[model samples]
Target: WAIGLLEVAFSRYCPITFGIRTMGLMGLAYAHYSFWPIWSIPIMVYAFLPQLALASGISIFPKISEPGFLLYLFLFLGAYGQDCLDFLLEGGTFRKWWNDQRIWLIRGLSCHLFGTLEYLLKSLGISAFGFNVTSKVVDDEQSKIYSQEMLDFGVPSPMFVTLAVAAIVNFFSFSFGFLQMICGSDDNEGLPLQMLLAGFIMLNCWPVYEAMVLRTDKGKMPTKVTIIAAFLAWTLYAAAFHISFSK
Candidate 1:
């Protein structure tokens, strides 16, 4: 039903049709059908690179979202909030002293310093750096970054430089991922890129792995025919990409 609804909603605005049309400007999407497996070979190769990041202390384990955990975060926050209320609205002298002591800590995390910084960074599309400097937008009246007047879509128009910068950032991102896939596993290994490829291969399997490992106890791999079909399809897609840009 969701797929039916999506088809109804986007039938006229078909993205794949549009995407293929865009690709036609350079070359047909299916121009190179054979080279995909070669490109995807590295996907498996780089799959282990993230392990290097973890061993080197630069990354952390993935946090798969679990149901009901958000309720826990909210409850924990509410309990803390209630404690704050008891220290504030409750009239005992000791309570008042305690509230004064904790006020700075609360103030620091509230819509104040660090929270504002976290919001700012997310807005800039700089999240790849792994820093949360700011969160939601501050009201114009309260924000000094923009004037009190002009506003559209709750965001400013995209700047040319912003697009260029995003492209550049994405280029480095692909380079880093590719580098990990091609590079050293050890002293005898050539480059570190294989690590990234291993990570990619794991990511490719992640949806099912996560489902069976965490979300469900049942474990099963699809039929061998299906697996081969998936690989061939993925490889063909990769081949197209590689062929289009191999020059």
Candidate 2:
């Protein structure tokens, strides 16, 4: 979807027809396809990167004292408020909406991030995209496990690794930011939003945390996957620290 959106936006064309034709209508169509997918990139970046920076003792978020910061906050709240209203009008419960938000964050962190990377690689002619059809048929042993009400491990493990690392990064970042604010060792007026974002991501990460430390089923995260996630999170922190030091 990300690559397709980029292609369509760059070409300024829409291949899909909706039984309507007008210059303004066409413009709206183009904007819908083009702009919506672009949101995933920033959502993915903001979900993890600033937390990583905070973990590394470098704050890159805007200060609360900045005039534009309140505008950004208002915009964020307005968008989410609209979604909440829509959900309520559609007879959706708040818990379901909350879960929906969690899924959005998860997809942004995993598939959307991967999609953006693949799009970039494709643009640079360093990667080729192809489709692989997965078979739905299961063998006798697999069927037996399914009959026992066991969960399916349909998602790729690497995605779980990414989620695990994001959760870990958010956890420590929120903790560190809180400590810094409490100790008054750092100028932390800018950290409230960052900490709120970290807390929000961590709240949505309960399932990931469960898989990592609680679940004992086949769908539970493997020990090696946790180790890899930890290493990657540490690597991101180290890189951020080095970059801050160099600056």
Candidate 3:
């Protein structure tokens, strides 16, 4: 019961990030099952194996040989490998698709990371908000206009503000952690992995950073949202400092 409650709380906090990905993956699976049943087996295996490995920390196949692990890794790559192949078959150049992937990765990671911070704040009772609509339709003319005006990219929401704060915080956190490790600090035991993950998260959050500070797009962070997010960010930072140092 307690676990279920925790799950509900988590879901509420980062509502759409993983949900959107899961839905996309599910739709892909459904398409494969409907039109190309034979490929479904490999697709399912590729999708599930990495998750199993993560959940069990590879303990489920503890004695697996290196070759077995490599095979699993290849299968994991197959998920995206299939997409690349599809793009090629559809007359898309590899270079173009590869370039496009960078944009997609930025958008995806930014959304997920920002949503995560929003969720954390919500769980701590520091932030609260209602539903925000995500539109499916794109208006080419409006996009052109916004692009011409150098306006922000999407809706002006607290999410972007949170993302901006997170990007800055993670950037500094990673830098300090990396410096500590390089200087061979005594307390740098788990800092490497933490710093690496933080760096990766920030790398994928370039879009947010650009939207918030670099670009004048229609999707840029609004002043009011920025102020609110800055306050929340400071609150979180203080709480983390207290928790880490008080111990």
Candidate 4:
């Protein structure tokens, strides 16, 4: 995640630095937190191959959503015509049709409630009028099922997890803080480039822990304990960063 932020800061000079690339890195971190072998295996693979493999599997599910919705939606939205003739019908007014569309999309997605829930949970005040399915009969008894994620990403690497906590805190701190600096001119200081630089650097720079420590620290520390340590890292990192860089 840190690497991504740095890349963005270096290349994609947005008003808020490291916006897009940090997204990739954050996904990597989340995988490290929520899925142990998932992220680790990819890293191991990348370590070995170092050529073709990218440790981006953690980002697969995440990047394939609403924002990424644009990519495939063009292909599917075209099918909306078929959706109208074959899928959507009478709701009442155009607004009614739109609301109906939402309900139908939700219900048709019953087969994959988990994926559907992914969209629903993130969307707030999102109720709308579109395609609504009045009566739908579909048997879920024979639905094909795959495995579920083991658990939260933290279960595996639970030891001395100051780094993980620091990552999360740094993510929100820099991400939101940058947003604030951009959106609200209350105290805007031209992007705080130095603070952003610190955040990106601190994200990747950490003490070298022996392999034994990393392997042994399986859910050893409490979540709360690590959370505190994480924020401290960010605070110290950002403060030291701006202090050194300030003119």
Report residue 246 deviation for candidate 1 (angstroms): 4.8
TM-score of 1: 0.20
TM-score of each: 0.20, 0.77, 0.47, 0.23
lDDT for each candidate structure: 0.35, 0.74, 0.51, 0.36
lDDT of 1 by residue, 2-36 (tens): 22223322455343454356665333233222122
Best by lDDT: 2
Task: Kindly give the number of clashing pairs for every candidate.
Answer: 37, 0, 10, 17
Better of 2 and 4 by lDDT: 2
Writing each residue's lDDT as its tens digit, candidate 2 over 79-145 gives 8889988999999988778878877887777666666667778878896555345577787765865
> Which residue pairs show backbone clashes in model 2?
none
Candidate 4 has its poorest 10 consecutive residues by lDDT at: 50-59
lDDT of 4 at 120: 42
Q: Which model scores highest in TM-score?
A: 2
The deviation in Å at residue 46 for candidate 4 is: 18
In the range 173-223, model 4's lDDT, one tens digit per residue, is: 455555655678453342343234325323332221221124233313344
Q: After superposition, how far is residue 138 of candidate 4 from its true place, in Å?
A: 35
Candidate 4 whole-model C-alpha lDDT, 0 to 1: 0.36
Q: What is the lDDT of candidate 3?
A: 0.51
